[model samples]
Target: MTINAGRHFVTIDESAAGERLDRALAAALPALTRSRVKALIEGRRVALAGGQTIEEPSRKVKTGERFEVDIPEPEPAEPVPQALALDILYEDGDLLVLNKPAGMVVHPAPGNPDSTLVNALLAHCGNSLSGIGGVRRPGIVHRLDKDTSGVMVVAKNDRTHVALSKLFAAHDLTRIYQALVWGAPKADRGRVEAAIGRHPVDRKRMAVRKSSGRNAITDYWIEKRFGPPLHPIASLVGARLGTGRTHQVRVHLAHLGCPVVGDPVYGRKSRNAKAPAALVDFARQALHAAVLEFRHPTTGEEMRFATELPQDFSKLVQSLNSVK
Candidate 1:
């Protein structure tokens, strides 16, 4: 079966103004993945005013600006019989890119084998999967945190799998993320160069340490600021990634004292005496895999994909806006 998606046109309104291009698309088209959105922008399928094309998914969209996109209609994936829904952004013979929602595990483990991305892919792709890193992941080239919803790329064949894996390992593949931080950043765009490693105290967490671990870098920009102690609500921040490491963006952002909103594990206690009542209510970490860009394995074409903020996140932002 052959799947061919279509093109979509979108306009930025007041509600979507200041949002990252990739993020707006993700929310606008829930079926498409973030990675696919970025690919479309990079491949010249996405146009911003005057037929001008954009390659940067993190580019901010102004109010009333119009943009165009091409969305693919994928073929009928072989039936494996799993009812789990998927946000497929782009698909072709050798690769697949998707926007994974928060709280959904990417792969199956001993305890979580039934409702994972792997299970859904198995059902959707059938026998067209390429094994990667052994049995744990069949076609998965990369993964996202269970609580982090964003873009992820997968391989459909062995050749594509090997090539994509090498690109990621060598840091050739570009990945960027957006996070809603509690505090404001000092600079609009600069590098947060730090070394990260497993937490010295916690076995499951990653931390920024003075010694040990690999190099990590994150860049951020302030999209909007709120709350003057006399007004209402809080602030919303945007960020981009320079390196792809385990929790690199999160840890670095937190290290700067601007931990993502609703991050129970790493976030500081709320400033407000009664914090849950605020406009923005984040039950989980407010982080998203906004964009993914790389060279296509089959066609050797450059591709990028992006996803927008989920409904829950969007609601929270609106609530915050209303508090003025």
Candidate 2:
């Protein structure tokens, strides 16, 4: 990778031959994902050698081919504050515990510039922040993916940030999520241990990799099955993350043949095509971070918090229970 006049350039090598145009380029630019690269290609922000612009992300590239990519300048440095409501469970001088709603991005990003948790924190914390969010990020020690409702802990100072970061890295805390999945597991409870990494061919999604992937584990229990005994339509599951990776609970449950209902990315819709209308009409992934437990960074005392299911989630459960 090389930079010239605010543009990033990558020369394809023998190793990258026959790779998808977006995949090859994204591999060179670690900061960009294939989906983002695809967006750039379609937006005419990517060009090939000899000053030829390309707009096809699927086009395969060969050795000796080179591409130039133009990344637009970022919008701003610090996120502007917003007066968003927060469900604060606990707070003090060094840290805060709150229930983050689904559909709220944890921080500001390209398309989502404001109304994020970080923006809300800026307004709520006022001048008390210690600037631990790093340049482009906020002081979030961990994240519950956007659209994943849950309890999260935010740092107010740098010391707390580092301490929480180390604790999460070591997997010394507890995280349990509740999800409504399409089918019940064969047993009452089980554990899934798999290594996850970017899908090799489809760079936009993650997959369980046979090799060259990071360790991930999820322990789950079948709390209740909502349909017939032999062939249940869906189940309420309690999942404990032994290790947290991106989409860990969703992916692992999908691997267990029980994809979370309303999960667009990893669900098997055809399998449940004839299921009741309750699940068919529901939208968004039926997953929530219900429990978060850890030791307070400064005080060294243990802490635990559990969040209630959103109203929509509760209604969905009621509908599922009424299914034949």
Candidate 3:
């Protein structure tokens, strides 16, 4: 049988004989699902070897018969692209790294249907994004919270996406964050090892629980202490994640009795009230993904990136320093 561009040809073997056309095609084309195969057949894009179109998804297949399926290009993403400015750090054919600013949602959700990082990426990458993640999250392998600002990487194709996902699952990548907390730790460095799950009463928040939830761990060190020597009001800390769970860093920090400053959900109101007015005025969590390290998916080269604090965070730190 002759092969052509944008078409896949498969010959039915004895093992596939007498099976429904959709089922047979699904086995032949592992990349396409049964539903997708049915859609193709219904679209009249599947034909027998002799050019006889097969529109019936349930038609029985015969042994030794060959069929061809015309593969369609992926459709445009559903999210509308806006001319949003992006802080791109690096880019190539396989992937891109960007500094995601605070207040930008990663993807569209119930309340946020546009102006997300996904929508911006759709416009930035255009048709180059990997469709494996579907239309809503094209090329997205992981996410950062809307209020957290820092470095993030995005895949441009399926191979890179799968590779990055595996790396994240194995915890083989490096993600380091810097945060300002309300109080200094008794010890300069320590680790928080706990299980994290959705809060029982508050579905939107994560809590440290022993009986339920995924194991989460964070290693942190005090970078600097602010305020009077005997009564330090705040501390700047660096945290490294061992397990990436929802709100893992914030939950672990709060569990350690040093909730991040400006974290409305996990921070204590009394502690926030004691902070300098400039620091208290900060709206979002005082956390930034300062460093990211990983190996290139295709080249195996070690890649590392770091970002400076945003203006708001820098100014807040300055305010704390002045009041110290």
Candidate 4:
């Protein structure tokens, strides 16, 4: 059972031409149970563009229509206890700031119903959680990618929840990150002004588009650069974020012709050195949410918190340093 499960969007293809909606998904994702697919379809969780729910799994899906399937993580063998180690950066009666580690799931789902940050908070906070999210699980104001380790904040009561949610929506909350990219940008520091929306072709990924999307922006600076001297190239570099969107840092860096190191989707083998065995061994993208700052939900006092880079990301930079 996966401790964390990521939601992936799939677009219907010509090969899936005239197949039943559920059948197509079940075929594409053989790992998903037919019953689960059936449940999702019957419950109208499958949606078409414009966010209308689609039922009738057997309904022949039309090409070019996007569909989202919430892939639940497999349930754990035993419930993960509430005692997992959590790095609490700051805390008050109304809210708590946590430095979430990489690989920790934020909440529960079909396959991953236990051992998540929610389960831990249920144990840790115990009866203090705000119910305003109303069965959306814990009061999660925002989220970090499962592999993206960094700081996050949670509210403890209803009033606090509203305030915190507004802060995120208004972009008043200060969110910053550090990332190691595959190559260096032309400018040391610059703003990436791009509109982001689901990919036109690959719905599973988000891309910067010329038209039709939300305003997405990212600002970055080169912390370091690396590559072999003999066949020199800037193989590694670091960056920060000015805005947060799904895969924003990865997409922005990729758009600049420098995807994050070890990023499977954005960084292809050709633009990067596949010949170097050491480079290929790199794991997930090298990125970390380094700081988050905002005012206290109830008290109205300003608060700021920070987290150190996790070991995997730290070691990756060290490896890059060794090459030069």
CA RMSD of each candidate after superposition: 21.1, 7.6, 13.7, 7.5
Candidate 1 lDDT by residue in tens digits, 52-113: 45668999999888876755344233223365889899998898899999988877654555
Ranking by TM-score, best first?
A: 2, 3, 4, 1
Q: Which stretches of candidate 4 lie over 4 Å from their true place?
A: 1-81, 228-240, 270-278
- What tens-digit string does per-residue lDDT give for candidate 4 at 95-131? 8889998888787656567778877877788788877
What is the descending lDDT order?
3, 2, 1, 4
Comparison by lDDT, 2 against 3, better one: 3
Query: In candidate 1, where is summed lDDT lowest over 10 consecutive residues?
Result: 72-81
Candidate 3, lDDT over the whole model: 0.86
| lDDT score of residue 77 within candidate 2 | 55
User: In angstroms, what RMSD does candidate 2 have relative to the true structure?
Assistant: 7.6
- Could you tell which candidate, 1 or 3, scores higher by TM-score? 3
Residue 49 of model 2, lDDT score: 52
For residue 300, what is the lDDT in candidate 4? 75
Top candidate, metric TM-score? 2
Instruction: Please provide, for model 3 over 214-256, each residue's C-alpha lDDT reduced to its tens digit, 9 standing for 90 to 100.
Output: 7898999999888876667888999999989989989999998
How many clashing pairs in candidate 3?
A: 0
Candidate 1 vs candidate 2, lDDT winner = 2
Q: TM-score of each candidate?
A: 0.70, 0.79, 0.75, 0.72
Worst 10 residues of 2 by lDDT: 197-206
